[model samples]
Target chain A: MSTTTTAPVDIFTEKIERGENIEPRDPMPEEYRRHLIRQISQHAHSEVIGMQPEGNWITRAPSLRSKMILLAKIQDEGGHGLYLYSAAETLGISREEMIEQLQTGKARYSSVFNYPALTWADIGAIGWLVDGAAIVNQVMLQRTSYGPYARAMVRICKEESFHQRQGYEIMAKMAAGTPEQHEMAQDALNRWWAPALMMFGPSDKDSLHSKQAFLWKIKRESNDALRQKFIDKTVQQAEVIGLKIPDPDLRFNEETGHYDTGPLNWDEFHRVINGDGPCNRQRVEHHVRVHEEGRWVREAAQKVLSFEF
Target chain B: MTKTDALFHYCLRLGDDAVILGHRLAELCSRGPFLEEDLALTNIALDYTGRAELFFQYAAELEGKGHSADDLVYRRPERRYYNHLLCERPNVDFGHTIVRQFLFSVYDRYLLEELGAAKDTRLAEIAVKALKETRYHLSHAADWMVRLGRGTEESHRRVQQALNDLWTYTGELFEMDDVDLLLLEHGIAADLHTLRALWQAEVKQTLDRAGLQRPADGYMQTGSRKGIHSEHLGHLLAEMQYLVRTYPQAAW
Candidate 1:
């Protein structure tokens, strides 16, 4: 309470140790701001890039109901990206800078989106598994130390739950339908399962930023722990829907009360992160292309704004 | 046509217009000029999709044939679709998309305003609900029309090009035949011919504000009344109807 005697860095560390939130104007280490900017912007980029695959199927959504739902869901993802970009902006990075970093391959998004949403079932699988995985990590982030990011996470988590359910609903319907539909669902699950797992990032020991992140309370859970939690919950949901988890190595351990999975292909994960995945170039290219194409529109809007002012 | 038959066809035409235009907007989901614009486009697409569902459901009810809304949306072949040609035009760019949306939304706003007072309560109710959304859509599109028209030289040029290309299709929106005449007599549909003047004035005002010229009207496209469409509708349907057509018995 004696702020006159305390250093700002000590107060920052003390606040972190005492599990207090960090506001935008609060005195904090430069490293912490950098960490949140990188993480949050990457998360924002993921949301924007994530739209492409799901957007792929909006026109082909089988039912009018499904089309509306899918369109709304993609809109939600776009909205989430906006919120996140604003959140990151609080830390001093411009939206333009973050987007430039992404386009230039200096920043990274979740590698899972690099995969194509190949079938209608892929739409379901993405909603169910991909969003499901994202929710587990994001739910933990709701308690993270950063006030703005945590608040954004809280709102995002709410919509993400709906997204996950809609996805699973698609998977469930397909799993229970005709053989072709069932095959589509299963195939989608098989392809998406590992990539979804990769969404949690590397294992605790191997994760580059886990140590500092945990010490700062920016991250509330280890990547492995969060991934495990997602796996345990999702496996049963898949079982009830009569679809199998593609992981042959998956098993529930009564002792730990956790479902264990096969070793993730870290090489593939790294490869995708390094821009070798099937859709990596396509995603970034599309983003750059869209941004370039919209230059005139953005310029026009900017000119109009100036004129009005 | 009987009153009920006229009502069913009326519903289909309305539903088809919504679905096709919604489909075109949906194609721009992640491809908008920017993130905010992207979300706005999809939101409009969603509104149209929802309206299409309501219209299709009503059509299904009137037909008394147990066809679900999905069936009406997915099972119909391209030639069977009665949407105006404008609805199925490709979204060539942001300029084109905005121009197309502006043109349709102006017409839609006037049509919905009249339909909201229809003697047929169901159609009126649907129109009333839809009018709320259309007003927002029209304003959003109109704002962009002005901005793009007056914004920068490049934007003005691009949008003007889009306007000229899209002008012909606007004629088909007012191409009323038996369905409109019959439904008009029954108080189930708005008078398209009358709606056209209001639509034209509103459009001209926006164009004037945006500093753009209305294309000289020429050879207006037709045939949506007979389920005929541009080459675009067939391709749009093939992509849209693929899943349902591939698995006819499968429920989504």
Candidate 2:
């Protein structure tokens, strides 16, 4: 019989109350470790897969200024994935193993990225709401118990703030411009709003990892809580830009003192999460092909590492 | 053309230089000799495109036509473009691409640094912001130059040949015109005279490190800035402007 005696629930609850970090080396519930791995790895995969859409626009960016900003942003996404994978590795997963999971589709990334960036406004939307939602969750993750992830989150949050501002700037210009530009901006927002909301993952009730993940201090807040926060913050930002918040029910509730928003299209969210979104196949197939094509480069890098003295 | 018209053309010229060079590099997307190099080239393309966009946007503002960056990039016909000749040439080979980028980046670094101080506030602002990224890009191209220049006999020979093939186009970069004279009068652009010695020294050091020889200055091509281009630019525009031409305001 394996004699790795488990600690009671109170021990974890006490640690949270005391604001102590739960290091990876510390023995915890099997569920907690698995949940952390799943969440962190999903986050890492999002960062990696996120490169494609932005990269598509790099060649077509209307100006050199937009191109440079996009390039740095995409590179930052790569660097963000590296940090996240390293964070996940602290839990004893190898980098190669994690990458394999992504390559093989055994792991999940944010489904939002599967939506193709059809226009320049799409890029602007991604930077604004997508990144805006991401920053909120990342700010929460900065308080996560894992030391490495929190530190990485700090650096990522700083860079992501710039990304968010740049995206907002693009939309602000469009919103203030010609009627066609305004309509285009509104259409982009309408398409991306729900996806951006879904980036916080499933609702608290639907989230399998929420309760225990919270007790373990791996997740500081519930998905629904983060989503509400994002919606409330985004509405004000939208108003300032002269763009309407697509949801008719989107308003501040004086009674509950939070934003009263309409229910999400959970069916679409679930379908996308389960690999049936518009670009799910496209995104995965592209990734697989690129990974295969990049094998020679990886081999060459390995050879360089082992070059004869 | 009035003085402002000349200034507008000058801005368009710089914008076109970056846009065409960016378009050339964009052809290498996913066609790299290696993945890192692929990513790096795409990244460079992205940077150049971004710089071009800023210039065109500024040009439109200066012209006060309410012309968008897109109107300048997509609506204008070929004869209207005023980019330097060097950037419009084909990406002959890997050696040519790297050498071209290296040569341009060095000049760009000096030009942008000087332009950052131009009396024209918009040009100066754009130059200051662009200088940081160009500095890094120059270092990246220089690093590759040194490596390929010194790596193997074949590599050295290929890069040397690229340098010789490209040398004829370098002269037009410093060739002055009426717009240049007008801009100089306004302290809006640095005289290429101040940049020549520095550009030469930088190129020599890199070439020397790479075991390459400088091409003798026998017959340098000129006049692309005045819209007399080599045969290569036509095909480049055909491909680059395809979407905008066909769709004619398809936002997506």
Candidate 3:
């Protein structure tokens, strides 16, 4: 019965509109709290799911330096996932509950992860396009209206910038290498480019959620706006590496000063978001299988944890 | 074998043990039970791989042929790899992997400590460089074994099963051959036979605290020194040597 109270909601809304950081103990609106939990947990889930595709290549990485780099990068993703899960816990949801949602397929991770990384160059493409897009979103997220989530993003964004650069460096080297290596770089860019753009989510017009989040300052920018920023910044990077963007419509309009043109395959994006992507089932199934298998291990850890020090 | 030949073979045993175990652990990179554990396991794998590279480099120099580190790692035949049989065992499950890691880390730390004090400055330097990482790995794996062993009925059963399954391979860690004897005579290697008593005592204490049982009087499996391995090593080498085998001297 007490959960139905809404008088304090107005004050919380006012604080958000004024751009004040929302702390965990603040008497926030029920919707606000739910929204924060959902968004934060989904984000946390994304970091965890994101590790798989890149992690698959660690043993096969062509060089010692590459193996170490990929391992460290993937490790950073795990650390980021842990940090985000901790932030989500501040909203009164347990990590187990959040993990359950992800396992049960009720929660959503980024659809970009639903694609497979087929080659070494794909790792580079992921770091450049995928992580590059993530940084843009996370940089905005760092400025958003939640104390703990914002703090988490600050730490994540710092690491993410390095990830973007590492990928680009790989691409730069590959594109300059032999013909086969250059082709591999180009192939990865072509395959991953559209998926990277769709990572920003649907456009502002068709978007079903997050507008109210914007008014509350939980979302600092529109999906389409962020997507545009990703495209504008990434095109030049592709050009520098001698890899062509797959879009024929990609051109700079001097008037709008934005990279414009190209129909994003929103149908494919929707399909992937709805669990129809190439790796959607495998990704979710693997996560579920591992989680299930880990029950005994977790149980053991819990038992030890309960013993008196 | 000449003294140099023995040193070369001795270094290969060290290098191969690290490389093979590191390869097994690397197979678990993205597949950990959880994010933190994934990070933890991979971090350990990285350390082992780094140490393997150093050991292989030293071995290549000791052999003093045209061989380089990668030549030792990628070009060597299956029979030429001299890793302990304990290291090449598959990571069947988390309990199995951690238990195997725990058992080996204890031996590894002890061996590294003795090697670090060797008369050969090169062996001593490499041992000192590697001992820090071995100690860290031992702490991590030992902690996990205790947790799983004392965790729950199911956890205890699975971990106890792993301990029993892996216990036989523990004997090979103390096995010595001509290479070991030669290196020991020159004060360039540890007395592994002596370290075994220390290792077994520590293991007994650890298992006692974790509420796990250790098998007694099992037929000990040995062959790493003889270059005989289970079916797992062949598969590991096939994948590990694929690119190298395909493109000979391919530079990434």
Instruction: For each candidate, give its TM-score against the true structure.
Output: 0.97, 0.72, 0.93
Question: In model 2, which residue pairs have backbone atoms overlapping below 3 Å?
Answer: A63-B49, A63-B50, A63-B53, A64-B49, A64-B50, A64-B51, A64-B53, A65-B50, A65-B51
lDDT of 1 at A87: 96
lDDT tens digits, residues A1-309, model 1? 775788889989999988989999999999999999999999999999999999889888898888888989999999999999999999999999999999999999889999999999999999999999999989999999999999999999988778999999999999999999999999999999999999988888666678899889998788888988998899999999999988788888889988878898999999988989999999999999999999999999999886552
Candidate 2 CAPRI assessment class = incorrect
Q: Report RMSD (Å) for each prediction in the order shown.
A: 1.7, 6.0, 2.9
**Model 1 chain A poorest 10 in a row by lDDT:** A300-309
- How well does candidate 3 score on lDDT at residue B142? 83
Q: Candidate 2, residue B38: CA error in Å?
A: 8.3
lDDT of 3 by residue, B18-129 (tens): 8889889988876788778988998998898888888888889988897878778887889878898899999999989999999999999999999999988888998998
Using DockQ, give the best candidate's number: 1
Select the stronger candidate by lDDT from 1 and 3.
Answer: 1
lDDT (Cα, 0-100) at A272 in candidate 1: 89
| Per-candidate iRMSD | 1.3, 5.7, 1.9
lDDT of 2 by residue, B33-142 (tens): 54357668877877778788888888898899898987888777777777777787787667788899999999999999999999988889989988988998888888
Candidate 3 lDDT at A281 equals: 91
Off by over 4 Å in 2: A1-17, A22-37, A59-72, A89-96, A206-208, A236-255, A258-263, A288-309, B1-12, B22-75, B84-97, B106-135, B146-223, B228-252
Per model, the share of native interface contacts recovered reads 0.96, 0.10, 0.57
Please give the lDDT score for candidate 1: 0.92
